[model samples]
Target: MQYFIQRHPLNYDGSQLQSLFTYKNFGLMGDSVLVFRGSCTVEQNEMVDMEDVVAQDWIHSEDMLHFIVEHFDMDLEKTIVRQRLLIATIKEELEVRGVTTLRRSGDDLYAGDKKLSVSIATLSPVSTLVHCGLNISNHNTPIPTIGLTNLNIDDVFQFGESVAEHYCAEVLSMRLARCKVRGVS
Candidate 1:
């Protein structure tokens, strides 16, 4: 597992949830989690979640901190697990930084009634992809939103790095546990 923070601001239009996004965009080979600052506008054509499309939910945000994870294994269930794990890691990081009133509802995060993040997981032909975006500014969103800046978190990149680091560690820990265990007769 590898992680890097993208310095440039890349707008996420839901098209980046493809395999090799990290490798093609940032040159990080193998399984990787990339964090960046971006604007999110996922039109219906680019959406992978059918529920959102059926509900006509508009996924948009003015400014966000985005995390894109790509793993070679092709398992949607495992990818969803990783998606939730990433969300939990973000909540843990926020709590560690002394921020309160944060809640995890499935793959999304909330600060009170206002939403703090959005996420989804799906499988490509070659990899499992996850996109998790944390709101940086509450403007230009379809729903009531709360951002990191609202909670006094100014170092967005650092926050992203911390979340990615912890997430990678947790994934590695799980892999280690699986490999080190002996099979019982």
Candidate 2:
């Protein structure tokens, strides 16, 4: 370690290396913005930064995001640490898409006999409007703009069944394409 540091000095030039430096500052240029289009963060996730994205910055209102979405199969013990890592991963990806900060929202499981809608709602009406596609019903609620966390998963089978029924699709087909549970474990 001492030899490596002596060979290549990493002097802190008094400018104070902010965490934002990790992003490589791609948001400065007008033409270099990233783009991604897909159902990227269902079984996986997509995170955005709040500080990087301004109020006036116009983003295309599509279900797709303009960044790389990652999927992981983790078996960690603690939720807090998992949340922190997820936040960091999401932050890095969001920066690539010209966004900053995250807003954690409460998740709701709306279920009926053959219907269900799993949605997460932000604390801020602005965030809810901006991210979650929320409407006028949340005008009275305030959106928190600090730290963000991910929601938990439950009964994927039930969810799949509901989605298939609602959309008139095949549950087995989707599972065959995405799941890794078929072959040898």
User: What shift in Å separates residue 145 of candidate 1 from its native position after superposition?
Assistant: 0.7
Candidate 1 accuracy as lDDT: 0.93
Give Cα distance to truth, residue 85, candidate 1, Å: 0.5
How would you encode candidate 2's per-residue C-alpha lDDT over 1-185 as one tens digit per residue? 00000112122211211222212332321111112222212211122333223432211221222121111222222222333333333434434444343333322111122101112211221111011121112121122111111112232223222322322222234446777566766
The alpha-carbon deviation from the true structure for residue 164 of candidate 1, after best TM-score superposition, in angstroms, is: 0.7
lDDT of each: 0.93, 0.23
TM-score of each: 0.97, 0.19
**Which pairs clash (backbone N, Cα, C closer than 3 Å) in model 1?**
none
Off by over 4 Å in 2: 1-77, 100-140, 144-185
> Where does candidate 1 stray beyond 4 Å?
none
Give lDDT for model 2. Answer: 0.23
Tens-digit lDDT string for candidate 1 (130-181): 9999999998789999999998999999999999999999999999999998
Error of 2 at 133 (Å): 12
